[model samples]
Target: MKVEYKKASLGDIQVMQELVDPEVESGVILERSSDEMATNIRSYILAYVDGKLAGFCALHIHTASLAEIRSLIVDETHRGNKIGANLIYKCVDEAKTLGLQKLLSLTYRQSFFENLGFVEIQKESLPEHKIWADCIKCKHFPICNEVSLIKNL
Candidate 1:
């Protein structure tokens, strides 16, 4: 399973949408419009396996030293292949390249992130900009059930 992780292009939006749809529908992740994703294409990294889209992760910069990992999804058929981990690694690598000191995520899969060295944290610890920009739009809003996790880059 040769997997390549690279920055996502505008052309990859549809494939990325499909990869994330299941989680969205299940309410495990928030739904994002294709247009919104296209606009933020440069913030994303996609994983390709044998020339097919296998997974994706996005690192959205919220401040000079902080970034949030968003929209991490792996194809259902390709789960358990370490593709998700690779996508995460790509996001962390990009964060390092950009001189970011922290990466955060609001996720249901706490143990999975814990295994990757992300520590569970209080959502309030995150910069207010992140909440104002993104989380406010989330249906979960003030009642968000997702656990907040952070990793020092």
Candidate 2:
């Protein structure tokens, strides 16, 4: 199967929502509002398999030294195809191009991120900006079970 990667555009938001909402409902990803998706649409990378949107991931820059890999999701029908990894690689490339020094992932799939060379870290080790700006808004905040991981670029 051939997978194509591209930067997300405003027109992709509806499909992005359709692809992400299931994961959010299952408590696997954070909920994203339409406004949020429209505003940060450019930060997202989309993966297409056979010309259909199959998955997505985003690189959210928090500071010159840091960015978070967020909202990674692959369609259930497309799991195990490494489309998710390709999405992540795209995010990593974007982060590097922006001259960011590190990539962060707050994830439930610890082994997955670890397999990609992200090392486990204490949540406290995350920048305050990340905690205040996003984490605090997460429905699972203060009791979130997601593991924090980092990869130096």
Candidate 3:
């Protein structure tokens, strides 16, 4: 199971949408329309196994010094193979390349993220500019179950 991580293009949106649909329906991940994904295509990184899409993660720049790691999902069949960790490594590498100081995520998998060296932080500790813009659109806004985690790049 050779896994490759690559920058996503408009052509990948449909597949990515399909990959995330179930999680969205289950309310575990937020719903993102294809149009919204296409509009933000540059922020996405996709993982493929043997030329088939396996999972995806996105690094969305929130400010010069900060970025958010979002939409990280591994196909159900591919869980526990370290695909998720590889995706996070790609995002963290990108963050370092961009000279960003931190990478953050709002995730339900707190222990998993902790294993990757991310530390839990109070949501309010995050930059208001980052939260106010995107977190506001989250279904759990104002009372999100997702915990905030950050890794210094």
Q: Judging by TM-score against the true structure, name the best candidate.
A: 2
Off by over 4 Å in 1: none
Please give, for residues 6-69, the per-residue lDDT of candidate 3 as tens digits.
9999999999989988888777777888888888899999999999999998998888998999
Q: What is the alpha-carbon lDDT for the whole of candidate 1?
A: 0.87
Instruction: Let me know the TM-score candidate 3 reaches against the reference structure.
Output: 0.94
- Tell me the tens digit of each residue's lDDT in model 2 across 1-153: 888998999999999899898788877788898899999988999999899999999998888889999999999999999888888888888888899999999999999999898999998888887788787777777789999999999
Q: Which stretches of candidate 2 lie over 4 Å from their true place?
A: none
Give the clash count for model 3.
0
Q: List clash counts for every candidate, in order.
A: 0, 0, 0
lDDT of 1 by residue, 18-89 (tens): 888888888777788988998889998888989999888889988889899998889888999988888888
TM-score, cand. 2: 0.95
TM-score of each: 0.93, 0.95, 0.94
Model 3 off-target regions past 4 Å?
Answer: none
Q: For candidate 1, what is the TM-score? A: 0.93
